[model samples]
Target: MTTTTISEVKSINTPSVIQINADIPLDQALEELIRNSKEISITRGKRKGKFETGADKEGLELLPESSKERLQADGIDIQAGYPEAPPREDIPIYLDQAFEIRNYDVPFVDRGKNADPEKKSLFGAATEIINLTKNVGTEIVGLQLEDLTDQQKDELALLIAERVVVFFRDQKLSPSAQHKLGDYYGNVEVHAQVAHVPGLPGTTVIWNDYQVKKGMNLNFATSNLSNWDSTKYLNVGNQGWHTDLVHERQPAGYTHLHLDAIPDVGGDTIWSSGYGAYDKLSDEFKKFLDGKEAVYVSAHQYLDREDPFGGPKRIERVHPLVRTHPATGWKFLYVNRGMTKRIVGLSPVESDLVLNYLFDVYEKNADIQVRFKWTNSKQGYGTSAIWDNRISQHRNVWDHEGDQPRHGTRVTSLAEKPYFDPESKSQREALGKYLHQWD
Candidate 1:
């Protein structure tokens, strides 16, 4: 047992001594001194009971040994705390390198300007006369599928690669003919879970009248209503902004809708370019959004809320805030009202603010949108439209109310999953592929 007194405790960048009253074992006395001390110094005394000087510190001694090792680890410089010295001034973020804001304004031009003249002409008269909007989309006319030759097919494929969506008017092709035409583009797959015309396996019918009647149990008197219930009814089924059938592990790629029967009034479809929506966002918003993900679940729209028919009915999937079209290599706004739920990295308030702002942007940009109004003309009867699901959104307007029933068949194409690419930006070639010259 030994007795010691702290005498005059000094900090001196080292452990200070504390005095003990009684003669005691070194360990016990040290523990009692530590317990009684007003504050404990960060540095502990050396085994020999002497405070460690800067020259004898273990950390200082190990620095040379660490430097002598051939393999050097890369990370924060722990020895220096910060590299070289602490930042003198708050580091300035280089906007160009730290963030990139893409231009969404797509230019309209002759898609064949870069191709050989002979090869360009090979798409037939339609390809020759039709021009594409230089901007993010295109509207095509003149070349009917019935008259499309092999050269035209090739040209159309090229156009599709450039423009994300293509619209044709006065098609005059039957469901079988339309399916045949779609076959040239890709493998046409039937929508696994939608109303289809009996016996017509390839076609999915967008039936407002039929759906309404069915809802009312086929009783006409009970189903008649003066006003339209946009939410409750299927005036335009799948009206929300969404890529088609993204709920499935595998989603449909190409969507073709032919206006077989047009009402005398109302019943038009509107499309918005996802690429344009992405391009219009502010740099601050884009940076905050970059690398963040969101949940997309189909069951939210398809499943019953009160008593979910298929178990709890949740089909959540994570998708990036911005995604690049795999085929076109263009960035697009990846979220949709129909499927997107909460953003992955954001708090509830933050997610709502950002998503609502994006939704407003998509709604306000008229230049990046196209509205297809269906007329009862013979040419309108033949109108068939095909668009890329990965980068486009479509909505059908249900304003027609008459005894005359309207119906059409849709053929969907199977496509690969959506992904994002940070390197490539939206280009004219990509825009030209879908928006034909004839807008």
Candidate 2:
């Protein structure tokens, strides 16, 4: 029998303690105790000190009675208590100390389901398809994402496969609608970590004031870290370019972000093309990396089973460095400067040199990227961007500087595992649009 003390909850005056012997993990034991035990001796105490002004407080304040009623009508569990706004004051920032297991084993679905681009008109209601840049981004001018038909959704999936990212403006898209759109693409990823919208399982909350609300002693916004790599270059700990959730077995496929609130100035987002990045490399270098694999680390840290007392370590997953897009059969550079670590068989120094150069090729190229500023919409509604995460990397520009608020909700769908097909061709090659200058 292992004797342990509950350090997470400590008594202010006199300790109220409970100890039991069980053949299970401490965290599992605690969870079982909370669920089964009738008489818990733990006393709830009012948290001392100031609270950070964040989304939770703002969202709770802005939550309408109709929304709550709708949630209840839809059979949402209301027992999960909401956080109350605390007095605005500074507090020390601490890391997540709770021991929780995060595992995802659901089989991935093919994102390009029943794609029929040849069908009469793909956009259905959309009047125009605006290519934002030469390579990566496109904007569907006339349709609301919420109103897309099954065929249109399939066409949109194919379009995103080709364009990498597409945008829609002046849209009245709700969290539920956005989630449905995500479901059409693949299995919507339910994240264990991060703050989610109330009653919405997979919808992640993207608030500018997250760090402050979470008691982090930081002056800048949480989005600031997205672009930190741009200033630091190849330095360690700088997250420059990144595809979301690359650590998952079946990595993130389609990621939809709808920003309901935008700042007057700053807070733009930029995305770069993986297809173009792959094309930028020489045939010799491409051949060298075609079948190679690299390890990707998770954004959140987890405990190492070998040393439970030791600090948590980031979860890692290995994927092909050059992956073939399932829909387009186009080879794209699958590695990102953020999550991707060293190559599988290469020495640490060799991997570093190769990865740094590959990252530079993707990040330094301007022609293969698109930078979009979220501004006025047609109906003064929110703007949305749906991107194929398998072939693109994006970074949020933190130029807003905390003067204004930017909040959004994001839903991501997990698709098939990263794979490389030897028979796959690069985008330009497949389109018979070879670069004469390079030749």
Candidate 3:
């Protein structure tokens, strides 16, 4: 029988090599057991007594009763913990493409055709549209997300692209159901870096008190906490407003956040419209920024092992400054105050001036924004907000003081990379409406 060493596995870049260094002691114990093993005749066949169990006694005790029974039936020592390593010949190693990180290709089908705003037409079933703002957010008052027809889901996608952010109250959407809904939109982003629901791949647990309750830290790559120092309080102005997953090769499209637990008051979320922000700029300014690109950096820093100083480096991506929504064929500003660092092909000072102005247009403007309260008056509990990440920036307000819990589950679907279409018109331009621009 051929025996493969740990070095051999490491040479091939086997993903399980991460465990080898830590499991050296177990390997040593297995070697000792094998050296001292005594052959015994069992019901199945002749085998080494207790030598087959590679685990320690404590490890075996920690295993489930069902697992122990199965091990006992297999003639393995249940009391002694670790299971014997199968022969190297039995373990086949094949290259898996799933281990490689690649750009997500979203199946983009424009569903705006199904969104007929006629007398009998709405997004399937009975519904009342509550416009939170003149431009950005809307609330679809009737249907449950769990029970949506394919046609209805298409229309809903269209509505979210148009409205930017949509809110639903008193809805029962489980983690599994949420994942399915996200998949319908696009490829649900399952981030290995974030804290997610147990057994649920794409559902990120957004519990504010998770660290305190679970004695574990929940660090999302989109969070800006790692970028700041002791001067954080003074430096954190308007930096919280950001589009989700901007550093990704294929950025976020639709982000659905379902808040199950919310305080009696406060912890409201505010979403700003990219469409409105773009319209706020002058025609000349829009023309200038139409094909420009910007650099976006991820919030978390990774150690640069190759560097002599061993300093941390953030993941960076370059995307168009102005991006067109595929569903609407409308151009919108894509830079965020949080992750967006600089504009390409411009000097440092020029880039800073331009980016700061663009940030202000989105964050400072109140008319193009929607602030939604999670605690419904009737439901008094669950509320959901599904926003189009392509044309919006959102911030979670932590105004709720004391130990009041604010918890939620979020599922984000990755869409196509940011692209600017010169043929795409602004919302106002497409609608033939006049927009007052900044002087």
TM-scores, each model vs. reference = 0.60, 0.79, 0.71
Worst-scoring 10-residue span by lDDT in model 3 = 40-49
Which prediction has the highest lDDT against the true structure?
Answer: 2
Q: Write the per-residue lDDT of candidate 1 for residues 150-219, one digit (tens) a residue.
A: 5665565455544666777666665666667666555565432343433344555555554444232222
Per-residue alpha-carbon lDDT of model 3 for 1-439, expressed as tens digits? 1222222123555552322233344434333332333331110111111222123344333333433332344344334333222222221111111123444455655444355534133443756878888888989888788887776777788889888998888776666787889988888887634445544557765655432232222223323442232114211212267788888888889889987667788778899999999999998899899999999876444433234135435567799999999888899999876688899999999998898888889888999999998865554336789999989998876566324766667899888777889999999999898977657
Candidate 2, superposed: residue stretches over 4 Å from native = 1-59, 62-114, 216-239, 378-380, 436-439
CA RMSD of each candidate after superposition: 26.9, 6.9, 12.7
Q: How well is each residue in 203-284 modelled by candidate 2, as lDDT tens digits? A: 8766544434433333343334434453233211112467888887788998999887777898788898999999998888
Per-candidate local distance difference test: 0.51, 0.69, 0.66
Off by over 4 Å in 1: 1-123, 127-139, 216-236, 299-312, 376-381, 427-439
Q: What TM-score does structure 2 among the candidates reach?
A: 0.79
Better of 1 and 2 by TM-score: 2
lDDT value for model 3: 0.66
Query: Candidate 3: where is the Cα deviation over 4 Å?
Result: 1-100, 104-107, 110-124, 212-239, 377-381, 437-439
Best by TM-score: 2
